[model samples]
Target: MDMSTEDDEDEIESAEEEKEEEKESVEAESEVIDETIILADYMRRFETRRMQELAAKKEKAEEKKKQLRYLIGVEEKRKRDVSVETIITPEDELTVSDRVSTESLVHPCLREIDISESQLKILNPYTVYRVPDDPGLSPAFWLLRERPPIYGTDGVQKFYDMVKRAGIRSIASLKDLLITDQIDLRYYGLESQVMRAICEALMDNTYVRKVDLKDNKLSADACKHLNNLLLRNSMIINLSLSGCQIGASGAEKLYNAISTNATLKTLDLSNCNIGNEGFEYIASALSNNQGLESIDLSNNNLDESCAENLRNLLSYNETLTHLNLFWNSLYSAKTWKTLIKGFEKNETLRSLNLSWNGLGVECLPYLSQLLSRSRSIDKLDLSCNRFTEKDAIRIAKALSTNNTLQELYLGNNPVKAEGALALVHAITPHVSPDNVLHLLDLENVWANKDILHELEAIKMLKPEVKVKLRGILSNYQLVGPDIKKILLKRANYEAMAPKIKRRKRNFGHFVMSLSDKMISQEKFMALIKKFKLKLSKSLINEIMLAFEGPRGTVDQGQLKSFYVKEFSEATVN
Candidate 1:
């Protein structure tokens, strides 16, 4: 009975332990379920908030797009409205002061001129713009031209009142006459009368500041009137009498007025028969003068006699920045040496034009010295002068050390391939970093392939340097298929290569007519037009020149074989 009771208690305890295990697992599973529910709810809320923010951003962007489109439409409408022209009445016509105040087109004061008494009807002053500060105002004023074009955009009507009131026709008539060197200029009746009247008109005029009477004939009486006008009008800043026969007497009168005149800044007496005496008078008058900045004495008959006066003027003159002695007779090396001395003292002169002066090998030494040492002369034009390879070498040597010269024009010289290569070597990147030469204008200097390659390499290394070559199409590369297509365009060849006289066939017949089936050099030029090649005449000539045979005739077989060989080589490559 005791054994039975013990077994029963053990079984009961086992049963209770099994029940406790089941209960603990159920509680753990319930807790996991609650955690999963809470996590799922938080994730759903986060997704909703993200979608809401994106939706709001998209709405704002759409609204901004709409506003931008509206503004663009309004701006385009405003432009269309402003572009339409409107007929203006006389009452709407702006007076001079009103125009000046509003920054509008300049017009004469209508109140001063009696519209009824005036023979002319008061047409609307070509009011170009309505806006107070339109940037197109200047272009609009330029478009309204009733008379022929003048120096700049300033119209002829602007000076009509003053010119007509002075009993002169429009100032445009005094445009292109040559003043003689004779002291008695009264015989040039029309020129003198017109010049005097214009001068008289300019005396009271306040608007005309720049007077360009270039290539015009002016008498002694006209010169006197011009002198008086210069004394009276203090606003004339630029005066050009270039290509006029203004003699020593006229130059004296003009420079005497210039000596006292304070407004003239640029004076161009180029091509004005001003000899050494005239230049001396100019130098004497301008030696103490202060207003002039640039003086052009180009094409003047100035010789070595004016060298001393030029040196004196250059030494003392502080304001003169540009001096053009182009096409003068100052070719003597002694004169150049003397001029170099003056340049050494004058630090203000920046540009000097000695082109066409025939300064040969003799003067190269002094010029090279100037290039090596001078700090002011940045531009030097020595084109059309006689310079050889040795001279070019000396100039190159000078350029190797100098840094201030920015422009050097050595065009129209015989600087061969060797000299050009020397120049390239001088300005190489490894030579000096302080080298400032940006423009080397060798416009007519001949160069070979090796020299050109060096120049191209230098240009690639320093992209700022510009080396102008001899021919425009010299360095161009031609494509084989392109040339073939141009030659094979048979339909257009009829027009390009016209039929031979008494023969209905094309240029092939013309080519066959040449002796021994070969075309001479002169006949080869006709083929350029015959080929109808859409290329520059120079380029065509260059290509044709390449096919020339030893006997000075184009080899027909070689000409035909070129494109095929080129095409084959190109394919192989």
Candidate 2:
């Protein structure tokens, strides 16, 4: 009985131990379940916060849409009532101060005289003068009121009737009358009468100091009448005869008037079709006249001989400061050199324009040398010339030393990469950090990519220089990828590769190949020619392939044949 009891106690202890292990496992599992539930709650809160943030973003986007709609509506309303005619006001309609009387006002103030006196009286003075209603007209209108009555087609009959009623004596009273300066008689086709009236008014009024007959078809006879009027008038300082059919005879007559007119300082004979003989006459007049300061002879047929004569006049004339000889066919290099020589001694002449003269590369050096000595010339134009890279380099070198030259024009020259690089180098060093060279034009240069790289380098080295690259570049194609890759490999292996290791590799392969079998010079040359390879420098590919271990069952003949085939295929493809 005692033995049976001991076995039973032992069995009970074993059962109790098994129960305790099972209980510990259950409690651990319950703790894990509770942790999972807490994690789930945290995830739900995070999702809720994200949804609220997304709702706020939606509301903000809707508000922005409303504001955009409001702005678009306002912009559409602004475009509805605009008129082109209200944008520009005629120059002659502008008025001076209100303190000046009509009689005291200058006669040149009458730009338009077509309106009738009754119509003029009906028109508001503020509208005619372009004056605000609150400010009224300027005191210049008082000056106009004190001046002689202005006659126009609108009120000429009434003006004549009033004159007769006032017992005015002769046509002299009508002669001194001030007409509108802005006359538009195209409606009546009475250009002839307008010219006559201008001549009459200029001759009658002594205070008329300037006249502008631009865009008017004044005949040669009218020009003669105007020349006579100029002879009588001494106060006129400016004359404009642009866009007129004034031939050589008319130009000669005008030149004669300029010779005697001491007060005339400015003259414009642009687009006058003045021939060579007319230029000769004008050149002669310029030689004798010292009072004229500026002359515009653009769009005339001044050939080489006429230009030579003008150059002679320029050499002697000290008073003439501004000259425009644009659009003339004086393109000879020898003639330009002569003209530049004439300018060397000319100190008073400051601005000169010889653009559109068909200059070329041969002309640049001479001009550059001349500019080096020219201290007075501040502005020079060599635009539209057929210049090359070499010519640009020469000019850049010249400009480096020339201090007086302020503005240069090379807009249409065919300056390529070489020229741009040279110019950037030349100008970048001498320029101050604060005051770099203001203008550089590389427009239409063909090889501009290399130039752009050099420019980027210059910016990295010196950031102050301002460079301009202009013109059409839609056709500036990029280099091919295969070519770029080959160039890059060549650059790295030949320029930056490890020299000692490359030499060892080359020497080791040469020794091993020679030791294995004698390689003929003919075979080597054949291999080079087959691969289209340059052998001046060793290639890593050649070395690696030559030193590679032999393959099983591959004979030397088979290897040679394989290499020959591979090289030939590479060359052909």
* Candidate number with greatest lDDT: 1
Per-residue lDDT of 1-573 in model 2, one digit per residue for the tens? 999999999999999999999999999999999999999999999999999999999998767645543432322112324477655335533532233444224322322222222222322333333443655456667766675566543333343445465554324333334343332222232254445555655554545555666766566677777778667766677888776758788777766677676777888888888878888877888888878899999888876777577777888777888888777776777777778767776888867777777777656767877766777766677667677788888877777776665566666677666676676666654442322345555555544454665566657766754666563234367766553235324533443344555432222122224333334444544544454333443453443244344431213343344434434443232
Model 1 C-alpha lDDT per residue in residues 327-429, reported as the tens digit of each score: 9888888898898889889988889999999888878888888989999888999889888888889989999888888898988988787777778778877
Of candidate 1, the 10-residue stretch with the lowest lDDT total is 176-185
Which pairs clash (backbone N, Cα, C closer than 3 Å) in model 1?
177-217, 179-217
Give the distance in Å from residue 128's predicted Cα in candidate 1 to where it truly belongs: 63
Off by over 4 Å in 1: 1-190, 471-573
Model 2 clashes, total count: 33
Error of 1 at 308 (Å): 0.3
Show model 2 residue runs off by greater than 4 Å: 1-193, 204-210, 429-437, 441-467, 471-573
